[model samples]
Target: MEFRATGADEPANDGRYAWAGTKEGHLFEVDTVELCIVSSRLNVHLSPVVGIYRVGRSMVTLEESGKVLIWGTFDSPDAPQLAGTFKSQRVPDKQNFYAIVGNELWTSSGPVTKPGSSAVSMRSPQIRVYDPTTTGSFSVLPRPMTTPESVGHVGAVTASAIVPSQDHLVYLGHDNGFVSVWDRKTYACLFVQRVSPYMITSLVGVGKNLWAGFRTGLIYVYDVRSEPWTVTKAWKAHKETVLKIVVDPASLWTDETLQVASMGSDMAIHLWDGLLRDDWLDAELNLRQPDFCTFRSIRTLCISWNIDASKPQDLSGTPQNLDFLRDVMLSTESPDIISFGFQEMIDLEDKKLTAKSMLLGKKKGDSKFSDGISSSYRLWHDKLVQAVRLVMPPECPYTVVHVGDMIGLFSCIFVKSSESATLRDVAKITVKTGMGGRHGNKGAILARFVIDDTSLCFINCHLAAGQSHRRQRDHDLVDILEDKSAFSGLGSSSPGAYAPGGDGTTVFDHELCILSGDLNYRIDARRDNVIAASMDGTFETLLPYDQLLKGLATNQTFRLRSFKEPVITFAPTYKYDPGTDSYDSSAKKRIPAWCDRILYRPSDELANSLIPPSGADREDKITPLPQQYRRWEVNVSDHRPISSSFDMQVKSIGAAKRALVWEEIESAWFGVESAMIAEARDYYGGG
Candidate 1:
């Protein structure tokens, strides 16, 4: 039951059967589908088995003691019979000492007896190749009989692979992080490149790409075909040392998408897109295929308000006698996307209401309500829908695509009726930072959906209250973003549709992320000065004192620093007397702070598209522009509502045209070399 597989090799071409060697010198036959041991041969070797490989019909097993055993075909009905036994031609450590390429066996040719000044040691910086088909086993080629002196201390060969796209070339990764490419026939070292200071742990060859993993958990891919071999892409693949890397056999030697995966000491395995072809493909379309993909400049209106449990009737009593909801909806001239976020939809200060909310909350699968506990949510939702329909052009209708409610916090998204048909993969999830995640009094509601190929996320949060709770609020916000199960509901969705930290989606996974709610950050200044600034319409002077802005400037871990917020020209929206334009008149007189705010992080494509080339005209820049960040004087709640309108550029790609562009770009970029690589892979049977 505690079997620790030290090495494994899949001999069956169908991938249904595998043979694993363990540290106890035991060998087991594994049924890969059921992942269980089917047969076992105990104490097959005198020492720990380090590597196993299948060459033609022979099963090759290597041990740490330099013992190699060749077995009869495992597909035979009889128990495994030792076909032959031979000593390894090189010093063996634990693993990665041997590899099977075609019908030849590739292993180290080492312990060459190095005479050193201090001590006599033995280690090989070169590999030996053998063809078992020969009557007497013999080296097929000279194969780097010795490493060149100019290469320096290349160290012992740790990992090696035959380049699939160029079968005549062999790649070797060393303990000193030096990578050397060899000409298989001539045994000449073509080049030696030092990739990292740390040891190279794993190497995978896919076409002209060589993916190398390091002891520092970093992964780098090099274009071996380039003149001065350069890293095409590199990323921190894990938090700990990477152990191994492999390419999916199915994707290799074919036009199918190549998947390169890595295993790390952190006990996590990750799969990556080899060569990042899809990303490059999309980038090509965005940059060169103008006829296939066009930009649509759509307006997005975001509003954040803390209603303090006030009903819609309170707005009717305002002096202007105008519909505040209708005015806010129409302020952006019928925005294509409208998001309204409200905090304190149910008065949390009321003990009875809070108790009822805690006792009778929304059940599973209930998207809208928590029984009758939060009636204000229903009223507010209805009022906002009514306002959208009342103000929009009669021909262009709107649809309430989603509504997420958490007793005291609510969020609703409305899109132009015609654009609603483009919405897909809609999902909403809630995170409770209240009472250590036992209650929903303080937390966030996140809604995410894909429009065509782009994904967007809206987060409405009510952070911890009180002037001294800034750290707590920061912790809560980070928790909401890092929550592992936040979007577990999207498991049934397509693969690679969303990737947060792991396999599920997080707030950061979306292309465009909009954050709004009662963030509870205050303007850090004298209460009197803040009030004076608000009264004199000099709120810009007080912007420097805003805690959120301060965090963006000073805090290294502040995640919102990446988001862009429109300049704050309006007065602070918090601590006002209900039904009046007055600051808090209560005993605890709270300072006037901008608690409710809106911020957004645009997609990299959109941001990059906005930048014009050198000497280009300003009008040529396709940028997402933000405007009209202001507050409404509804005077119905302690916090005035803040709103902003963003003119964002969205991509609408034509499939048939995109395919034509893809073919054009791939042909021009990869040229005839790609075709040659495919033919070479097939001839070598590298897959």
Candidate 2:
């Protein structure tokens, strides 16, 4: 059933002055480049603004009461003045999108209104187009369908997009699985087509075809090149209502891929390869045949830094998070790749709980609060640049790439600048299984790439907070690992194969997986004893009580029995007061815990005799584990970020490794064979 429609937005325009109107009657103009609000103003219209549009040198804002307010957007010394006010006598639908044509604002404000008649219903077959300069309005009705018996009423128009090739044409999607092409010049419905019975929440026009996303999480491609538009294809795109569908700008000229990206209410964004749908479908069905980009091996040094989106400095006036990250990047030895996972990269401002969180901000100007980059991500980017330029060896300078976030949780990867020439097929995947339902307060981000010839993956996740949410926390962890299976995201399925499970559910699926973030696993120890343990350096005694470590051992989550985690030696990394080593003494008195962590899972075996590094071998100093693992006592956020530096072993991709990866893929379905033992020795030395 369709939801009861509320306020509607006037059709949006993509011109020089991008306009956004809030519910409080405040209008803001934002620059596309700087990605921040450049200027803002309030209007006399007290109703919530549902739509904004840019028409020539003027801006139009649509109010809830079907009122249109136009203001001059001139760059003169004088402030913007109200240009005109008009009413189409039409209300907007929150789920419907409108477009523009020939200086007119087209809106799906509810049912078509007849001249002098005021019956308004979502089931009406007509749409209203309003002229920007005048209150003049006209109706565009859908052509009749099923002979003369029934008019082509397409439920409520939920989504719409401009057809680039034909400016006079627009695509309209309805809640009852109806799609139609409406002609602005002739006021005729070119054709009406019905798909699955689901609401079309979003639509995007790509080339001559139109893409539509439905509330059922399905996607349909309409080939509108010929006289009769045909539904070319469909795919299951998401698990929840598809909120928006956007074409990859790069898809314009590239014949290699007709890629489109989408975000749904399920708290996840999906990247689809439109051209390679068959290959994707096949892999989705047969997970073993996932053609992961095979590489010999890749080594990565991973550090998880919680830059305390709220106050990132310490009492000593040091940007401790930045210092910790920079220092590690400089001192960490030759890792082909480096990744940093960050949590709370922006201060969550719930003013009722406000405590004046400080941030590393830009000068008061265009970049101020620019996409929150000033206070949060930019710090990580700037620190990496400084570390590479000032500290890293001249020959091995690194170039940083931001694996951005859906919420504030983010992850980034740094690779040798020199390797850019040889590195190929880089992919990044970000999934937000938000703990706060669909709001994205918690989730995971991943960056995958092949450096030289080795494939590596870096993962960062923020799970559900608090001790009582243990089950929810573990579920989020398992969700990320499972959702990322079988090259389901980014560039292509890696060319390599994971030896242990042959399944893609875990990062163990990668050659070298370094997963980190604030896991929020609190200890049950008494606060006094926990504080004393930290002060007396007997914190290791609390290791047995750590929830995350214990959870992994008992449950089937991660199922990574072979993955290795370095022993932690630092004090509890949580609930610290900003700028000091003291624990939280606030009213809530949050318990201290090692919430921030870094763990690595190495690939099982590259060759027959490789005998992947494990347990007992570490005592001999030849182990594959990190050389150091400890917490950084930088009292920046309530949680002290931890760092791990290690030199991992990676074999170069060659004939031997290639054969083994393919062999493992086949073995996944066929099961182990006696010949595998003999074949292992031939490819990998039989250790």
Candidate 3:
């Protein structure tokens, strides 16, 4: 059926914004730039609107429900009228109505039936012909007698194309692989061809041949003139069902050029040029597969001949001249021509993963305590407490490694490097409570890294002691463990009991993860007591923490000699006062808690792997004492750097498989990255 034009200015083009009508009879406008829904309204038909096209200032909508509505005014809005309507036994799958050579408006409808539902029976495939200039009615075209009776062959006609030479039409797709052609005027079946048993999903006319894409991942080129429509070329072009195909004639002869682009359920876009004899021979010999070049799905493919004076011969033998073809193909870059539907799915998955990592910091302004005293107060007194916490940026890449009072400034450092041993300061937020106090509010940052595909590394950092402030510290730690806003649900709480300071399920079934940080509470405290006292539990206090950190020798990357005492590498960082010279005097030296530590949770495979014989011995648990303390060093905020090594193993097979799937996912939604980002902004209530 044809729609009468409703007087409406062609949809307002705010650059990338465009309107579309679906087969389900829905009118929607998408922000071409943002890929967001600008507006959507359900029109007349209950089923999806299958095809939409614009002529002059008006839009023509065709619905699968056999109802067509014309709302845009061809001449004026007030003059809008019902253009035409057609009823059919089956819903139309593909529809195209074009003005033929004469004033006659010829319309073609192929087999497109609604999905089977419990309440409705399946519809048979049929084609409808219409003369818009006549009474504006349609009738089912006579079916070819040779058409198969099986549902596979007579179900939905997947595709239809009008031959450029005449009003003749090619209807070559099926729920089965049967392809048939007919003369529109005579209703004569010229040929019937079956290229494969697999269902034909798409059809494209290139030159004198017809290309058919199959659900079985194969493509066949048919010579329509030959009896029974001989198949000229056939190749396996995809790993999954082929969804759509577009032929680019201009790229037919270029070196390793792409003559056709196909998208499939696998989320990959495959590019193909006509196969060379050698390539086909290799495939036949099982020596090589067809040269199926794959691109990220976001890329749309189209053909353009080199029209510039420098390469005029590129247009030879094509139907259109170089300039005209170039104008047609290059008017919209290949990237813009193709569209996809699964971007939302991929984006949803990405958002889900990002949320998993958001719980790495304490909620705003929560107090943290260590030992039985307030670590916040002690750090504030020492001028080491900075702001107690800082909100992480939405897209911050570094995983928070540690956060605590460095002296009195709230200091936090994130593990900036994903490769090896490297920690960098991501942010050092400073908070001023009053004239005398400047505290650093470094939010705890935690990250789970994929170590060579199969393994992950979890790094944690802890800050020095404080009694009553331990509760806040515990809360911060818990926040880090449970936040899902960052990595989108990829992170979880410590796997175990939910008691404060006790370890819960941190990593489950994941290859390997290392949960390390400055767990302030001693490793021997009871979980319930720690929770009641509001004290941050130590490494030995929580069952999982104790099991993971106990017996793991500390890797001290720095050392200090306090009060000129015999070179000492280990000293409690909190007890030293800058004014007392206790750090410089030789008479009395105070030993303090081993506040800085690093732990490694190596899997069995990694634990058994031998350390490289040439590198620094992995046995160095204590860092050598620095020869002298710089100005910042004397107070330099207390904690020393700690480092460790892991014999992380690579799982090549798993990694390769993951890479393949990832490539497909990326390809399937290639151009829609910005759309996905926009969706995220919307989901997060951002503009």
Candidate 4:
């Protein structure tokens, strides 16, 4: 605990720079001088305000969900106007979205380095500036590779701040310690500079001089005006990771009264008069400590299902549109995340379905009717979105953050506006396990995303139909579970979920994996007896009769070692007559069995990792399985939609705690790298 607080607030790029964040999802504007929120608004936005900048006429706020709103700052407590909003690249943005109304600098980081991924390569598209008004954006590429071996992997753009130079240039920082000064007008690389050997954490600029904070507490002063940026001064400033550095943009370097403040993980904020100071530069051995507060860990979890609508023509009937959004919306609070998976969204006869085979055979090339299948998919997706919005309350605004389809299997994910701030590292992968080897009548899609630093995966799979073809169904399961693309990480052009395995590959790699779709497992019992038991509420007695459950348990072929499923409390969900509540009374009197269902399996380490030993025991804090995991009453399609809900624990360790943890990791990383450098020097010097 430091007497002076280590605030995580970031300084604005504007001349009258201010900091804005949220207290309970409402807006808070901090005065740089007072170092406290000056204007706290009354109008509450459920979406936590992750970013805010004061530009020309209004203050622009970027919510966690990537929603950008331009608000009028004239009246301190006035309602901000909603400005143009667009989706930025998905990454674990530690509130890393930096915007200059002149030109916004934000990062869309590469995929999370899975546990066993190879060392990350440098030099890729990581940073960019976009105009909220325009549809296009300019990419800011990093400096050229300087050596065969470099400290940074041209990886994530760790930190960036708008340089208050004459042109209002953007000073971009990378994990690799390289810096680039770029022209906002042409986005041309103006010059490159490497000021530190350690990782660059944050940057601030005043006139011609740039101040950079590193993972080590060292701060570097770079003269940006020099052809090759030159470091004028370097100082060990803090006892921990330097979280942020802010200089008054209006102050000139020559001004003796130039104000600069540095905050660090040390829990102490230091106010330095100017860049050059020999006074107390070393980390203080004994500092006054600030009292720490108890932190709470709890958040929302939701599950939804998409029942078949028969086809596009019948979407509006049965009044066929009973959607699953209502089950997902939390009554006491908003679900931090929601998942909706569709069992079937396309037809076997559709031309797009056969296009893959045709292209490979050279019989017909890709269709020029770019509008054909995609346009239809869009139309269907829009319907789903519109239906979801109808059930949402005005207070809790949510949006479709991700949408993907693998042939007939479709899934969409929605995030509440407030929870979008921490949303990042989203990637999608698809694999076909249907017929003709590569072509499909069945396949699956795995959408992986990171929310609140927790990895979650949703798999929507459709297996081969027909009761006798269980072998093919099992093969499809193996294909989906053992997908080779998952190990490719973000390197492959086609990244998808792999089967559950060690070292975090595929869906098994995520902290939580939610699976839903038509598994097509039938009851091995006589059809008549199965139908009778279903009617008599004797599902328990018929449990053993389920071929899918029994077969999966015994068949090592497709059975993942540690996956789990909820107890089937609902009636059989397959082979029903369209537009009727009755089961298939026709020729294929499908033995009533739970086919369309939802289940979840946690990564082996998730439970142990999330539950701290001092906190509630895993069993006590565990959100109990949802009672509403029953089937939806909608009867538009042959298969009933099953929706289940769960509460995922969100460990919202505040920024202060994160800074402390980062300090440990950074210190360890820096120490190891420094040791490696020394080892290399020794080896080379001896030779």
Candidate 5:
């Protein structure tokens, strides 16, 4: 029969048996080896058990009503005899939670616990200490220590733990995306750092590392032993919000690798290598040696524009540029892959229409809203496909790989029909960054796929507007990179799971990541001077005033700084008058800036192309070379369209060869580990 387990715990001294509590107030004594219930008792508590803990030799079950029941010793399992019961005295948490730190029970508490102190705001939350050893008696510690009010809000505590390797330290995860460390003895807040914009769901202290699971299904491991801790590793571990994380005790005994298990809201549990040791890195290098790989060179064309809500038919104009799409397509000759990205495809000033359309768009599975909000995307998609058919030869057909739209932003990718079969794990996802991610008026749409064995990703973004919102645009880019929601219909195992040829989710997981859009960064200069500079053809002189360029050159932002952009050879692509060569004359008179642009971050294989390989073919490594970067004067919108072309290398015949290499590496690593473990056990005098 199927059973839903609510709370479970294994004894610290025994590994053969485990205790579990169910939502129906039933308790089960399960055998770890047989995976069957050895004994069970109904009506163990009146309320549903929310947590189960191991205290000394007794097993305690916490109920939803704040009552905890302690059972007698399990040396002789005769249906667990109830030893005692007590109603926990503490402030109730949202999850009705309690944590076991040694023999004491810990719960959350509000601010202002001490008398005669300034009535602090609830922004400063704390953890209450209680002793549950003496049943039927209230034993509490002194005033609970408050967390640091370093920010406007610390948020409620979601999870807490005391480091197993360092018993003097305590770590807590908060809903405000901050993690705080405290001294267990003095209860003094030691360090506070904001790790993510998403809420931290669970925290676990193992060895010298602390693992934090986020609501976005990502995991971050921190090294806490040193002063001012640092993130050791971070990756997507699940498809939904993680509920809890636990480490296998047996794995911890090795003092090297850690085996972590996490449960998420997606109704699934995931196992991960929580901490990567030196041995793991050595194994990884052996598997990805690149000796048996083969590469194919392909040309890619990417075009981006802020269309300003113009329809495709309106793209027709003077004889010199009668059909804008065809001219743009033929500008780059015989590209193997072509991508079109458009921002502000719909009228953003219509707030009511935008809000309603965003709400309805979520329900229709990539369809337009009832009010025709996505009609512009459909028109552009058809127009671009028709343009491709007209420009390319009939023998060399093109196929639409994927099309993704996020309200005012749209992105579509196409490839030569002959290369369509080489695509695998193709996925498209949209991230909303407008109004605190509640609306899609400003956001990003991303498409990722594996071309043969090489992974590539394309991101089309429309960041926050205004000349003074540079920081907001940087934050928007970070949010897009951190999003790890597994693409729908790819199954739970698809994300973050090991597969051949670097298969995974997230933007950075790909070998080549291209970002193109109306990034909205402005030139730090007066409007008249910017317009004069653009008109005088002295655009190269204005590079120092470009916010995006400054950020990239100085490496101001974390992820965006890594990308490289082609040298600007054309004038600014923004703030032009419709159907005219003049700059903006409206009241806003927006300064001319290179807002529409493309940037790319290539993998290390391309970065190390200068060095000769040991034994692998030098041609096997992919090196992306930018050929052209220019802008077109199609003035249907206030912003001119920008395009970039690149000659990118892709893997063609390498999956089978890489898989064979991986098998040999795996076997060698297993043998090495076994011999080392045996030798160490003999030296240390242990089994």
Candidate 6:
């Protein structure tokens, strides 16, 4: 579940404790003194709790079952108790809740319905102004902050935060990327602004503005005083789903930094400082490699401060010795700079890993497409590689790196560095289906490696298409692998391939460690039953590789499409339509499909130590989406990239660790290489 830090300081000689809640309907009192779970009670109902807040000495909790529990102290001497419960009549599913005045609660419910429908349940959230002093019952405020007329078309209120000012209640956030503000006193919507179609996941009030965090890891800050709620700041700071946001007020005053801590489903925590005020400047800064020169990834830069600046200096000139400081300030900013990198693929047969520069392939006239692809890839790759190098350092006991491209091409590049470095390549060696004609022969490099005592393999493969041509693509891929005996004669020796087994066994499978690319075939037409049964592939089919390799898959295979309004404007690679939006009449027609994925197979030791048990998809449960069938609306590519990790120690054995630590490395190898491929199709109007 989720944890929130109370304003209360950590328990010391005093008895103050940090409070935490769970989706399984439990409230936990954690003692900071012992750093242990002091007490936990399952008094609430079984439904997931949306939010918990403090009202004086009492603790308030809102649950998905549409119930609110007001526990904690009602009298001075007595311990906190269940004071009362308030239930909502208009909106039954409590998506979220917040506390204003004591006993008054504001709640929102925008639970995603079934897939393929754009009509979101815009249930106008209610304000229950209660008098806990009396019967402990809440009276629904007659006039909602957002009226039916004003909020009727707006999507559900995904997030809300209390403004810093005590006199006025200003609510600002997204109902599907539409920034809306409401006056808590009159219950009237002041203004509505649509920034992005993606759901607003988190909202934090920073000074006079509110930062709206989106599902795509973008943050937009709106100043309430401005007539139109000016978007003062926006940035792509996180790599995956941004789950939480925390701000430091002290930093605002110091004018040193603006610290924001963002956590995501990628199992990463990122910290961003130095707000880039100009959109063009922010865009430019994001385009360059984050670690180039003195600059570090936003995550590293954020945690560098010792949290305090008055402490005695240390010999290293690091922030570790400074007094703990939470917040910093933002002053001068930098301009937008365009920088690029390369993704290299090493041919084991040739004993070489060549560098491929990350670039965008456009039909020459499109600016948006060019900016989105090149800039987006550069931003993502830079962040990911930097995180890996810093967070999971070589000196750390174990680490694994997983990288993929957004356009449905995937590769699991595994690096095991203890003393030296060894790489592995595992391309598809056999296909399970029939081979048709010349065009039917397709090959995928599942993985590549330098297999010494320490073995590391990189597997890259794109699954079959999702449309009617799926059978052809699927069969062709499998045929190439199946005809391993004839591969030596087909002139399949590209710059990326490893040589045929020099010993002549034709198969390479020992204590093989793995990195894999799986094109999760969401739109394949060949398997009618499979496709119809699960547009997002069945858990069974997706689990085999995970089971066999003893590793975990990183992304939710099936996503509720269009939760966020369209961001990327590329046509689907699998399903092409000449007249449809994703198809450019001037360019070749291409199909639309979501079918790129990544998976990691850990060594047995690593599997037992780090990977969580059960290969089921957990992210899908956290955020559900309504279904919609509009094409080429937002994603750079129809398919999102997937990546997973493994433990280096487990992948290497007793004698191999010392020799594979310092191999020459290229950071953005795979993505850079994919950018050079021929353009698939231009679906957007101009592009």
For residues 340-393, could you state the per-residue lDDT of candidate 5 as single tens digits?
A: 999988888787778777777655564655647756887888888988999888
lDDT of 3 by residue, 61-87 (tens): 556655554444334433222332322
lDDT of each: 0.70, 0.57, 0.36, 0.54, 0.70, 0.36
Q: Give model 6's TM-score versus the native structure.
A: 0.37
Tell me the tens digit of each residue's lDDT in model 2 across 189-230: 666666434467888875556788877666666666654344
How well does candidate 1 score on lDDT at residue 591? 85
Candidate 4 lDDT, 1-687, residue by residue in tens:
001111123223223334346645565555466676555554344467666654434455566665565444322333333322323332233434354524343544442455666966334334444444333332233332121223334445667655444445666776656666556565555555554434788887644467888876766666566454444444456767898887542333234234578999998788765433221111110010111123233343434333453444464454434433344444325555667777555455556545643344322363222333344456667766775677667687777777876545667787777777666667777777766347544777788766553456777878788877777776676567542235324312211111111223445456566777887777788887877777888777888877777764653223432355667777777767877878888875676667776666633232211111122223322243656567765667777777666555433224475456445545654454445334433322311
What is the Cα-based lDDT of residue 345 in candidate 6? 18
Candidate 6 wrong stretches, greater than 4 Å: 1-16, 44-48, 73-103, 110-136, 143-152, 165-167, 249-259, 271-687
Model 1 regions more than 4 Å off: 1-270, 273-277, 289-291, 320-322, 364-370, 450-454, 482-506, 554-556, 606-627, 665-687
Best by TM-score: 5
In TM-score terms, candidate 5 sits at 0.69
What order do you get sorting by TM-score, best first?
A: 5, 1, 2, 4, 6, 3
Superior candidate under TM-score, 3 versus 5: 5
Q: Candidate 5 clashing pairs?
A: none
lDDT for predicted candidate 4 compared with the true structure: 0.54
Question: On residues 328-384, what C-alpha lDDT tens digit does candidate 6 reach at each position?
Answer: 101101101001111111111121111111133234664222443344444434443
- In angstroms, the error of model 3 at 359 is 44
TM-score per prediction, in order, is 0.58, 0.48, 0.30, 0.46, 0.69, 0.37
Residue-level error in angstroms, candidate 5, position 536: 7.2
